[model samples]
Target: MGLECIRGASLAPLNTFGIDECAEQLCLVHSDAELREALALADQRGWPVQLLGGGSNLVLAGPVSGLTVVMRSRGRRVVRRNGDSALIEAEAGENWHRLVVWSLDLGLHGLENLSLIPGTVGAAPVQNIGAYGVELCDLFDSLQALDRRTGALCWLNREDCRFAYRDSLFKQQPGRYVILRVRLRLHTRPVPRLDYAPLAAAWQALGLKQPDSRVISRLVCDIRRSKLPDPARLGNAGSFFKNPLVSAEQAAAMLARWPGMPHYPQVDGSVKLAAGWLIEQAGWKGHSRERVGVHREQALVLVNLGGARGGDIMALARDIQQDIERRFGLQLEMEPQLLGN
Candidate 1:
């Protein structure tokens, strides 16, 4: 019922990368009161506070200092339901994939395309998580967060969150707000989004008479399992880099040079280039050096081949970033947050 504290906690098991590092102090808080108490305790002791969720989307760069607070709060339920529409709320600690399945079980649509993403509900808006043809912002109604600056609980709407491509207000101003829970607007009527080519093809292959959210979710899981590695078996943070967006003119030039290169045009007169394709083209796919390597199946994923340190992972990532920049004149931004210096 209170904050569970540990000193000199090993963080290797917490992160997906399994980087061996220790936090000076770690607190696992299961409720808002506990979280606030943990923060107050850290502040009183003059220890810097670092937040963590599922640990699926971060890089433990080195041994962390001060107090590390892990959000472990949990709950999920339908807040309300209207004619063919519903509003659902979930506590921060709820697993993302499980939330998707829960929604489907409730006959809710909209989250099927984002079924297999890692991390918890609290971390979703931080990265504006997206997959297949859907993004979290599409259904995000609002979220309850503790604003550190004011020490007050606040409700932030979709526009208030300032959601963008893999970005949000929570990410823009880190350490300023702690997301406590999230609310989503979903539909009871089937309105599947299969805009992604591969998803559409897989759906077509099924040849079902009508769209089924569960079936769509299964297909998504199947696709993700095939492309991404299981963190338990092979230590990895899925998709190490964000797909770079280039100007229309830049995209035209790149297309002219490599006709086979994959590109997706945005409504904002920009083109999104596949980061994995660029990395593979630069000959880094399956490339290994002692303990770290690029995943053979997914060039976007950087894997830790047992006994790899945080420094080793960053070194590989830097090499890949440099190569992609040199080869394509594009910068591949890392998707995972670096937790330490």
Candidate 2:
């Protein structure tokens, strides 16, 4: 397909935040050739390019200047299978939750714990997206990405992507590589990960000793729906802040002061502190200012009640960050990518 560009495109419909913003130019690419063509055109025009997937994890500041490329490619297939294990590949544009469901439908099990995560498959690896006790890196096999500078396709292994807690190499150097497709490995044999306390409790409450992948997926979906407001009904980018990782000493200090603070020790000896607890402790839960507010149910989520501007949301987030820092002496980093700078 040839590159098609729309001038002065409204970005509100494209992003999950529903903030009204205009992109100077917008192009939707469905294939590698089309994506390369769009990049070439942007380069020729000296326009900076921004890659957008399912805008589930973004905070648009205002009007976006230059070219905005939306990945719309689609495909999913089991590329290789062996006895109990199989390799699956999905195009960048496929919905993440849909892929999880598709895997379960085919009797695959690894992705059951990651159910209900919003955004496209392409954006998954970029964020190293995780939920429950599973992360994309756990199932990731490899991925194909297009180098914007050289217009070459490169196959990156799991290590090449440099996956970290809610971060990746793609995220480190933004606008350099456009993810085209992702390959993941799944198992036919049931490999339920019911380690997370909430999931384990839900499973136990169901009175089932051995639940299948479908059951686990359904439980995760239900749990997410109960806590998070649907982006369609209420504009939100899910969790707004990354759980801050503190050193052992720092964690000990906070633990001494609060004693009820939820924390998880990492292999590297750092402790991961729950950002939601901090926000709630700082007294921002269910807090609203005009159209933007912190979600009443989930403190991690910032929502647009009705016609909220990006500035309002950003300002509110900054205030929360400042308050949390002041109260706990810990800095919180935002999870969403901020655009239009």
RMSD of each: 0.9, 1.1
lDDT of 1: 0.93
Residue runs of model 1 more than 4 Å from their true location after superposition? none
lDDT of 1 by residue, 1-341 (tens): 56678999999888998888999999888899899899999889999999998899998988899999988899999999999889999999889999999999989998999998988999999999999978999999999999999999999999999999989998899999999999999998999898898999999999999889999999999999999999999999899999999999999999999999999999999999999999999999999989999999999999999989889999999999998889888889999998986
Residue 13 miss distance in model 2 (angstroms): 1.1
Candidate 2 structure quality by residue, lDDT tens digits, 1-341: 36789999999998898988899999999888788788889989999999899899999998889999999999999998999899999999999999999999998889998998988999999999999989999999999998877878999999999999999999898988999999999997999899899988998898987768999999999999999999999999999999999999999999999999999999899999999999998889999989999999999999999898889999999999999988999889999999985
Give TM per candidate.
0.98, 0.98
Q: Candidate 2: TM-score? A: 0.98
Model 1 is weakest, by summed lDDT over 10 consecutive residues, at 1-10
Query: Weakest 10 consecutive residues, lDDT, candidate 2?
Result: 1-10
On a 0 to 1 TM-score scale, where does candidate 1 land against the true structure? 0.98
> The CA-based lDDT of model 2 is what?
0.93
